[model samples]
Target: MRTIAIGDIHGGLKGLVQLLNKLEVRDEDELIFMGDYVDGWSESAQVVQFLIELSQKIECVFIRGNHDVWCEEWLETGEVNMTWYIHGGMETMASYDDFSDEEKKEHLAFFRKLKLYHLDDQNRLFLHAGFTSMHGVEKEVHKPTLYFDRTLWELALAMDNNLDTKSYFYPNRLKHYHEIYIGHTPTTNFKCDIPMNAINIWNVDTGAAFKGRITGMDIETKTFLQSDPVYTLYPNEKGRNKD
Candidate 1:
């Protein structure tokens, strides 16, 4: 079965749908979503509903992003932080403005059940963001780092395959898997549109939250697919203005 890893969606359900249609998914193909599925465009709820349906057809692994954490907290405590709202949480809330209580509950459960990271059979690590620390994926992990850290990517950028001898990068922070695929930091930050690889680290978030597109990669084949520019997909909305 082919293993595919998708980057952040950020409520660009149209892009997500287009990308999915472009992919030739087999029944046994494994699909790993890197997270930030909501909090962008005007289709957060629609995106979640689409994923719920998609899950019924394929084996899907979903990771939780920081935005998703905010969403989950809002659902449980009814607290809305401006920081989150400004970063597209407003759109997210509006997307669910009409959901029934039971539907909201199901969505919350889906978000809560999302894994922070998924280690595939090929030993590649798929996460929404980088990990500050890991002990065989058994130790306590900080969710923030898992959703926002770029240090790992920076480290990977600075080092070649000889990273083992680097002065920094503790053994705990060093690479231990075949590869680590992440999505929190967009490739637009690096002025690119395609997925990027440094050493064994892959950054697939093509800045869909800003003006880039949703991207998916077939890990086994190393082939990648991307949607049209996210801005065009939602002419009336701008997700997070990171620039």
Candidate 2:
């Protein structure tokens, strides 16, 4: 059985379908999604539906991304901050316009039930975003894993900008897991490769929503497959522009 780890979906259902079709996934294959399953595209609702349906057919692990957390908040309170709406939540809301109230409730429940992280039997850890390295921070801290805590985000951003590998938060000294798969920060942050690892943190978000490709990593072979750009954004045509 082959194991494939896919990068962020970010509501790009067409892109997701194309990638899956290209992969020709088998029933015995293990498919793991790193998260950011919704927002930033016209089919957030459809994406969720597809994931729900796919879960029944295969061994699928869905990790929660920052956008998913915003979705949960909106579902629970019927209100969200402007930041959430500005960062693709508006698109997600648009996708749900045709849903019945009951359907919406069910969808929200599914989002709430998503796991914050998943660890494979191989000791490979999958999470939506980077974890805090500070002592006493729980392994299950929902805020940083789901949303960008300002302090942690800033620190990561700075490290990336400076290309300072030593500044990264190496989870458990990188010995606990063979590799850590993460999404949320775009792959553009690093040059040459879509997989960016800093202090053992591996970021796989390939910017699919901004017209970049969806990436799939084969852990055993250490190989990767990238679908052609299916979605486009303004300012830059290659999908490098931050939307």
Whose TM-score is greatest here? 1
Tens digits of per-residue lDDT, candidate 2, 1-243, equal: 888889988778877888888888899988888888887777888889898889899988887778888888888889976887878888888889998988889889888888777877877777776556443223545555444533333344455343433444532334455666777777755543366555445666877767567788777776778766656422222222344
RMSD after CA superposition, every candidate: 2.2, 4.7
Error of 2 at 180 (Å): 0.6
For each candidate, what TM-score against the reference? 0.92, 0.81
Give residue 83's lDDT in candidate 2 (0 to 100). 89
Query: Of the candidates shown, which would achieve the greatest lDDT relative to the real structure?
Result: 1
| Model 1 agreement with the true structure over 1-243: per-residue lDDT tens digits | 878889989999999989988887789888899999988788988899899889998999999888899999998888998899889999999999889989989999999899988886768788887876646344536557778888888877777566653456544555468888999988999899899998888899998888899998998778999899887988877677646
Q: What is the lDDT of residue 71 in candidate 2?
A: 89
